[model samples]
Target: MQTELTLNERHLYLHRYPTRQNETLQAWDAGDEYLINHVEQLGLPPAQNIVIINDSFGALSCYLSKHHNVTMVSDSFIAHQGAKANLSRNQCVAITHLNTLNELPSDTDLVLLKIPKSNRHLSWILDKIRNTLPANCRVVSVNKVREIHTSTLKLFEKHLGTTTTSLAWKKHRLVFSQLDASPQPISPFVEWSVDGENYSLKNLPNVYSGESLDLGARFLLPYLPKDERFKRIIDLGCGNGVLSVKLGQLNPNAEIIGVDESYMAVESATLNVKAALGPEFQFEAKVNNCLDDFAPQSADLIVCNPPFHQQLAVTDHIAWQMFCDAKQVLRAKGKLLVIGNRHLGYDNKLARLFGKAQLRQIAVNKKFVILQATK
Candidate 1:
């Protein structure tokens, strides 16, 4: 179903994609509407330089585009694509310039943001805004009413400035804030120790499978190919480049590449790769959507720990996309290795994509299984 959203005195019909296998889930939520409503009430200045962060769909961007000059920031390639598609559908001129977390534009008069579900990523964005914007820049952060509280305010206070939540509207809340009179230097990325490893891991807020290693990833570690004879290796959906570090260790000479949709994840992975492998490690990690830009028949081996969700809804489209993209990028006789829950039926996906899929290992009593597919 499509939603006709009226915001900033303009009405737009935004197309929200349904969650995979769950047709009932809509692409957007009340939080998005609340942000738009709050902006409309502000009677925001014309041609004002406004920035919006974490807009899940085009709802917020499409509305703002009609009146104010806007800049949109998000980490998901799919979300960005959805926003553009919706803009075209509505016959709306793109008002806000869209950018990823890795490339934030400079100072602006106002910032309208939807609180991302990942607290880690939110904190990073807060810190980034604090560091880049002037001391008096205004920021409005909107979220569901149930998500606001003292701790939430404290998080904003810690980096940007004193923050207060507005009264609830339709079970949603907006945070009013300004850059603190004296903002500290951007805090370092949050750091955590990887168990059984000497090197500490660091992360930006939105990176996937953060801090502690993912359960499925942990199970897939030992099964990694023990030899380093492969020519080209990719850590598909590489979060913080952990698997790349391991893959590098296993095949010291093979060229490794890690890719993810989150800018923070790519930054963290780049740092971790250098720290873990010393200056000798040869690899590239960048912000991308499942190798969307990779050339076909290029990679000789691919490793993946595909994500099961995008934002709050669970889905396997990302996994399916990863598998499909891997096939396009893998050379003839190349292989793709993945670890996932047994119930996800990834074995079938692999079989269909590669024509040959085999279970390499399984952890008894655990849902994780490692599978290999060859082209």
Candidate 2:
């Protein structure tokens, strides 16, 4: 994959966060390039306070920060780390990095957005902009032409203001919206109870399966390994901490930890776990890239519902990396329990990582499978 981004006679070396030696994907896509090129052509005055939302890896900030004060907003911890690394690698000016939960800067003159895959997330961001930022701020967004639809544009118009789209370039398109909409109350957190369980889960806007229990998780719930011998349990990619909460109930003495990349996901998980297990429960929800910072052989049990995609890109690299990390962190004879769609072929991947003899199918349905691998 290309690491150098050449725009306007300038070159910036960029990489995705937790840079992998065999990474096949580039840090930025055509949509990112389209947005950067369009902004450069506009020749916005220097010193303008610019807010860049959902930048995958700081491509927009790395380019614009040289001339303008930039505030990078994202819901991803990994994306923020990537942006920071790329900024340092390119020797770009230091720019502000803000999580999605933070209020948009009121002084922002321009907003550059990379439309997220989740419309709920997009609506949440647009709501923040409408409620906090000035109505005159120009919001320019970019996405693959195939991803944007009439419904997507309607979201922009409904939450922010009048919106328009540019002609497709390189299979990508730009959306322009004027922030003229009246401020509306932000949506409330989604709350739901697990089937046959009294525990209630509260999900922030960007949390995975926010509206209900994920189907895979629902399938895996009956198979979750419960043992008092599990001293340190991890819920990898824990969305709303439902699995962590369940594990806590089964093995009350085990310390449960939830790890996810999204800031909103981690926050929601933290809240849900606390609400379910009480404030004194031994639980921790962390925003991280898989288990990159985890100590080797520190976990006794790791339960995962691996995601097949990151942002809008459908890929298996993340699931692969999570499996590898689980192998590194699990103690001797410790187990990693994973649930995923059958077509993802996680069984073959786990067999390769943990050896065929160490992996076994715990349960399987028509659509999903729960596999357990022993370290």
Candidate 3:
């Protein structure tokens, strides 16, 4: 990954994920650069309270903290870990960290937000800021120019007062708005019922497969390993806890855990599991990236419908890391079952980690293939 970020008369050394191996991928993107440059160009005064939302890896937080105290908000566990590591690596001071679901810290004098892909979630966040921040707070949101649309503008206009967009520079655009007294109500949850499943699944605004089951996960459901001997099971990348809830229902004695990086995903998954499998079922859902801190040989079964993309970037590094984590965490003779697209070549990747991986054709689908690896 690129080590040095030089723009707007400042130099920053940053890395994404803290373990990013590719030399070309930089931690901060053009949007971040545009936002930072715009802030510098505006000659904004030192903020009494500066809040940064969706800072991918401490780029905005670290740089902005030098000028003003910062409160960083994020949902990804990996982002927090990476931000902390990068901040320490650069010898920057620590910033207050809060999850997106948590309330904003103090009254915001200025907000620096990075717009995400989910428009509803963006609206939800806008509502949050409108309701939480003090009146007349300065809000500046930045995104790729392509992401700036009618709804984006409308959201800011409605939640904040008199929103305006800056001219595009380096394929990025910046939005400036001043907070108003009117606070709009927002619902962060969505719901859907799956056929043949006994219960409805709940999802938060940013959770994967927002209101419905994903096609890949739909293809994976019937193939879930149902064994009587398994005592511990993990639903890797358990979006909305569908797989974990299903497994828990099938094997009532097993201890089930759902893991994901998104806080909304974890919260939705926990709710979905308990709603589907009754409150008595023992299950846990947590926000984590793959398995950075998981114990070795702890799981008898690991099931995953791993995600291939990280936001707008299409990459398999996350899935590779997840498979490696599964291999390390599974007990002796335990199994890891994964459902992935055929074009992705997950079988070969799984084989690279596990000495061997076997593939089976699950009925009713040609786009996805189920691969199982034994540790």
Candidate 4:
């Protein structure tokens, strides 16, 4: 596998999970190099406080922290973990305030951002920065040539100020936007409803499938268990808590748990559950990796709409981990309800893990299938 080889004095090794088939030749993308090159040209000394957004791995943070005091933030707990793991693997300096995107730290001097794939999430992030960024803070967003254009510039202009783009380097471009010095009002959190239920979400651009309710979630909604007395229920890999909300509404008495590797997903799900069930509704929502810390035989039901990819790579490692974790945490005869693309053949996985799998629902497009597994 290829790695991010920093300067000779310091380096960080990074890798995406499920190993890319041709990683040796791929290595870090141009976005990584562009950020590094920009820093070098500026001849800037170590920053007092630097905030990094949406760093997929340790690519940007690992390099910047070598010279600057860096605070790494990301929506994905897995990404945060990956960055730290890579830092340790390369023996880099400990990063300060390795926070999740659900909350931003105070006193940031400079910001380095990797433009996220979701525009809505990105807008939300810009809004947050608008409210907190210092008067002199510099925010640089970078992406591939096709990913940046007039629309991207407008997004930054809306929240920050007039933005400009750099000439293309290795087919990647950098977006430069200055924080507005004048005190401006921060926009209210976007209020939207899910299936007629009210919700308030604080999203950042780049959160996986953030713009709308996931289609896979819609297909699985009809199959939500109506088991009223369910003692313990979990939403494994709950993105935005849609599955958990459905489960909570159906089984009001059940103690619902929503777990995701993304801090943003956990935050969104927590908001969704509270909005759907009201303020008194209490449940456990946390940034966790597929029941990694769950106790054995602790759950009676596990509902999941497993993610199919991590970063830019499409792989089933996370889905497999969710299924395996479900099996480990579920008691004998406990059930695992899952939704996934039919092409992914999750049925075979359930069968292997639980000894039996049943098709509960299949969408008309055949793009998704809901499977139930019993341990």
lDDT tens digits, residues 55-93, model 2?
999998999999999999999998999999999999999
Clashes of 1: 5
Question: Which regions of candidate 2 are displaced past 4 Å?
Answer: none
Residue-level lDDT of model 3, residues 1-375, one tens digit each, is 567988767788888884764545667888878777766876867755789899988898888888888888987777788799888987888899988899996577888999988887888888889888887778899998888998889888887768888898889888998876378787778888876777788888888888678998877777777789999999999988888877987889999999999998999999988888888888998888898789999999999888988766788888999999998999998988888889999888887787653434444356888878888
Tens-digit lDDT track of model 1 for 160-234: 887777888889888988787355455446687766656677876566767578777667777778555588899
Q: Which stretches of candidate 3 lie over 4 Å from their true place?
A: 357-364
1-375 in candidate 4: lDDT tens per residue? 556565535556677532445554333577988888887787786666788888877777778887888888777777777677767776779996454354566688788888877777677678778777776888888999998867878888887887888999989999998876343454423444555444434433444466666778767777788885579998888777777777877788888888887776777778778877877765889887678778999989998888877776677877888888888999887888888888898888887777654434434455877778878
Among these predictions, the greatest lDDT belongs to 2
Deviation in angstroms for 328 in model 4?
0.9
| Predicted structure 3: lDDT | 0.84
Candidate 4 segments exceeding 4 Å error: 4-10, 17-27, 98-107, 181-188, 196-210, 279-282, 356-365
Which has the higher TM-score value, candidate number 2 or candidate number 4?
2
lDDT sort, best first? 2, 3, 1, 4
Q: How close is candidate 1 to the true structure, as a TM-score?
A: 0.86
CA lDDT scores, all candidates in order: 0.77, 0.91, 0.84, 0.75
Show pairs that collide, candidate 3: none
Better model by TM-score, 1 or 2? 2
